[model samples]
Target: MKLTVVGGGSTYTPELIDGFARLRDTLPVEELVLVDPATERLELVGGLARRILARQDHPARVVTTADLDAGVADADAVLLQLRVGGQAARNEDETWPLECGCVGQETTGAGGLAKALRTVPVVLDIAERVRRANPDAWIIDFTNPVGIVTRALLKAGHRAVGLCNVAIGFQRRFAGLLGVDPSEVHLDHVGLNHLTWETGVRLGGPEGEDVLPKLLAEHGGPLAETLHLPRAVLDRLGVVPSYYLRYYYAHDEVVRELRTKPSRAAEVAQMERELLRMYADPALDEKPELLARRGGAYYSEAAVDLAAGLLGGGGSTYQVVNTYNNGTLPFLPDDAVVEVQAAVGPQGASPLPVRPVDPLYAGLIANVTAYEDLALDAALRGGRERVFRALLAHPLIGQFEYAETLTDRLIAHNREHLAWA
Candidate 1:
């Protein structure tokens, strides 16, 4: 099967390449295309990708190109991992929101809205071209603001599923702590992308015995530490919240912390520079250890599993993915995209039934879903008013003054990317 990675130039590509090399038997990739507008980074990543595959004795032909249409043409699947405005824009996304005393994050609050606005249109255009190239091809989005982007793709009628490393990362972590293989550990992961909770940790399958309480009872300290939350919070909730939730559970504290530290974008930019230098080494045949610090932990594994499942290859029958709710959560609209454990196959993902959500989480999920609706609207039909409204709707930036200021800062920093601006 053929596969295409639209942002193959990204520093994250090597991790993905490593997975494709190791999991060849699962996905059985024949041709792999790396599509990117940045020719220099593309070549560096592409060379490393080839060397990694060759060292592993994988026979997939690796191709690199700047032409999106040509790169995706006739591919069996296309994976979207592009950052529309690069790290510089991300720096702005992460910095400007802090000025409003809000969490400065790439996929939450004002920063997330900015990312959604800049990303959705570009992703849509790529999806449209991919649709034209191979109507049967599946689109796997690993881009930030995945819920909004995936919603755009699906609403436009593209064959798509959204993948995030959060669930897989949690699976691997829980397995390590439980002294079991990752596959044997199943997470009752639910909620929207980047805003999810592990309600239960089952062993064997979806119906397997729930061992979440056991995990919390024994491993709550480390788990809470990883999430940057207090152990008491986990014990109180009886569920492990994704690290991203720290932004919500401790908004003011997070904003204060963000203000003191350098933006994640800046740190990543420095890391990418070092990573690119490393990628250029002809002797480097494996993904560098530094890439792990660059984030997207276990992204390669998640991508491989999702792609394999979507293409009807050997893959996990149930995985956490972002897809239409379709009433999986009675509180969310049917069309709203949510991240949850689902049965995945060539027919697409069907979310498994979820237990009744506690009002604590359900209220937040519903609030964010509404904000995402406005974010998508501003992304699709850009306007100052739309941007302001979306910002105001966000739980993190509900005040009009902050929303107004953030809207201007977002548009000002991103005017070149926003056509309407």
Candidate 2:
């Protein structure tokens, strides 16, 4: 099996290689191509893979290339980890948007659409290359705004899968909170990437309404106390939510309990800075096993293995992933791809086709989905109008004037970054 990483220059590349290498004992893919625009960065990952090979019982030859086509051609599996605007630009992307009172979260809402606007062109270019070079290769995209980006890929007619590690980490958190082994928890979650909810989680068996609420009562614990979300949402809404759900509701109610702008803005900004520091610190790299540890922290093995298996053998595996919505939910627009588990394989991804959600909450979420759609439209079509729509329609942005002001400021602030369509 030939496996390639399109953006092997990323900080996460080593850990991803570690993922493939660790799975080598089980899945046994033969060749790995580390491709990046920067030769030096690709070499860095190649060196790490080589070191792992030197230590291993079986060492696969690792190739580093600056050429994307060379790396992707004739490959069986491809993992994309590219940062199109780079981390610095991403920081600006969030900050500028937040100054507009746009909530400024990555890979969700209008921010996600803005991210896709600049990124989709590049990603679609890669997809084109994959089509020309290795038509059969399954592209496992790890890019942000996964659902939105994947929609572009699908619109372009490529074989790819959208993946987010949020589900894996949350499931493990549920495991820890519930006092059950992580492996023992049967789970189901659905919604767009980042902002999703655990529809159901049970100890053993599936398909009982009684089982669902009981599991939440036991397993939804304080997002393991690190995140203010799952706990806060559970406390108020009577249900645990995906971690990023905090951005959806009023921040004042969740953590600092402040409803106004400046204070909430300050608190949110501090949160971003704090999180970015954890990632940007070079000293942390000296720890040797941070990526490997983090990969485990997310419980990525199940999802990773599922894709590898699907590619190799074509057995159907159920997994929650971001993809184009072709009527997966009864009321959700056919164009909006909400995240949900599905039976997947060589043909492509298909949504599991869940029933219409309960009336009270689903309508509210559909409104959120509308914002996501506007986000996608704004990014892909590249207009001030769609941007205004996304902000104006957002669940968080609230009032009309605030949304318009935000739209104006964010568009002006990120002008150089935006497509200017």
Candidate 3:
């Protein structure tokens, strides 16, 4: 199979290459294309990818190209990981929201909406090109604000499924805590992407015993620490919220903490500098340990499992993916995309039915679903009023004054990328 990565120049590529090499038997990619507009980083990252594959004796030929059309042509699957304006833009996304007294984050607040507005059109254009090049191909999106982007792609009728590592990361952590293989842990991961909780953690299979209460009873303190949430909150909710929830649950405190530290974008930008320098070393044939610190733990495994399952190679894997709700959560519109555990195969992913949701979580999910509707509108149609409305709808920035201020900042920071502006 031929697989193409759109942002192949990313520092994260080696981690992916490492997975493709180690898990070669699962997906068996014959050709790998690294597509990026930046030539220097592309060569460095692509060269390292080749080295990683060669070290593992994998036969997948690595191709590097600045041409998106050429890179994706006739490919079996295309992975979207491109950043619209790079980390400099992300730095802006993380900082400017603080000017409005909101938590500064990449995927959850005013910041995430800015990213969506800048990213959706570009992704749609790329999806169109991918469609023309290979209609049979599946597009696996690993972009930020995934629920919104996946919704846009599905709305436009593209064959797409969004992937995130949140569930896999939790699975790995739980497996370690339980002294079992990661595959043996199945998460009742539900809600929208990034805004999800682990309501249950079943062992062995979907029908296996629910050990969530047991896991929490013993590991609550450590688990809460991992999520940066209070143990009391976890005990009260009887669920574990994704780390992104910290931005919502402790917005003001997080804002204060964010004010003290340098922006996360700045830290990543520095890390990229070091990672590129490492990639330039001809002796480096394996993924650098530093890459682990770059985040997105277990992303490669998630990608491989999803691709293999969707292509009919890997049989019947239950994975967490962002796809249409299809009434899995009756409260959400069937067309709305949700992140949950599903049975994945050649036919595509179908979310397993969810147990009755508590009103506490269901209410928030419904509110965010409504905000996402408006957010997609602002992202696609592009008006100041639409942007303001979307911002106003966000639970984190519900007040009119903050929404108005953030809307202006978002537009001002991303004017070059936003055609309507």
Candidate 4:
């Protein structure tokens, strides 16, 4: 099987390719294709792939090209990590609207919606190419507005999975903080990609049943120490969620509670700074900068690592991913693409549809759908007015009267930018 990675030019390209290289010995796929509009990064990624497979004498060929078709043709799996418009464009998405107190972010607030508008077309175009070349290959996406893009692919009737390092990574971290062995922890998680919850955590030992309940009553426990969140979700769920989930839940809750909206740039910048600095300290003396860089605050799925577990390692592996709901949660409506637990094996993935989320969790899920729908709308139609209204519905938007004021300002403020279509 030939595997292809789109946006092979990303900074994370080397790690992802190397991560998958380990899988060459096990999985059926043999060829590697690295595709990117940027020829140089594509070559660099392909070169790295060649180097990794050098000793194995594998059939792998790290072909690099600008032609979209060559990248996806005859592939068994395709991974997309596109930064569609690049950082400069994303920065504009953040800074332009903040002038009016209505911050725009790439995947959450109006800013994210704007970026979605620009990205959706490009993603769809790539998917269409994959459809003609490798119809059955699973499209593993690592793009912002993951839910929005995954939904679009489903709407077009393509097979794919939205993978995020955030959900599973958080589950294991929470387990570690809770002092339970990672092998024994079973997580029942739900919500959108960045926004999710560990609704349940059951340890393996006989005392495991009571561990979650006790943590709930205690309000804050040792497990809470690992979380960097706004509401203490596990505290609210009666347990602690992964520290990464804190990113979305904090934003989700602030919009729910105080009704004040903070700028998304401030959120990303603050967290990025903290994470970057944390890894930058003394660890540098031992490992080379490249390996340290990924461990250090860079969000990556270690796609190859996950592939190993899901392929045939024997232990049950499951993760909540951005995929069409397919009625897993009865109340969610199959159309809503939610991240939920799914069992994986060699044949492929089978999402577990247990029951509807509680009314409270349902409410949170609904809020995410609203935003995702708006992003899809803006993305496909390029309607700035839709973006403005989406902002008006945001939990963060209604909290402040200035939101409508800012909306009007944004309409006028971004007249040209909004009128691009």
Across 276-344, the per-residue lDDT of candidate 3 in tens digits comes to 999999999999999999987889999999999999886337999999999999999999999998998
**What clash count goes with each model?**
0, 3, 0, 6
Q: What is the TM-score of each candidate against the true structure?
A: 0.99, 0.82, 0.99, 0.77
Clashing pairs in 4: 104-111, 105-111, 105-112, 106-112, 117-379, 234-239
lDDT of 2 by residue, 35-88 (tens): 888675566556666665555554677888988888888988787777766655
Tell how far residue 157 is off in model 2, in angstroms: 1.2
Q: Sum up the clashes in candidate 1.
A: 0
Judged by whole-model lDDT over C-alpha atoms, candidate 4 comes out at 0.61
lDDT of 4 by residue, 128-217 (tens): 999998676667777777888888877778777677776556556656667766657656677776667666666772224635565455
* lDDT measured at residue 276 in model 4 versus the true structure, 0 to 100: 35
**Predicted structure 3: lDDT:** 0.93
Ranked by lDDT from best down, the candidates are: 1, 3, 2, 4
Candidate 1: tens digits of C-alpha lDDT, residues 1-421: 8899999999999999999999988899999999999999999999999999999999999999999989999999999999999999999999988877888899999999999999999999999999899999999999999999999888899999999999999999999988999999989998999999999999999889999999999999999998999999999999999999999898888888889989999999999999999999999999989999999999998999999999999989999999999999998899999999999999999999998999999999999999999999999999999999999999999998999899889999999999899
lDDT of 2 at 406: 70
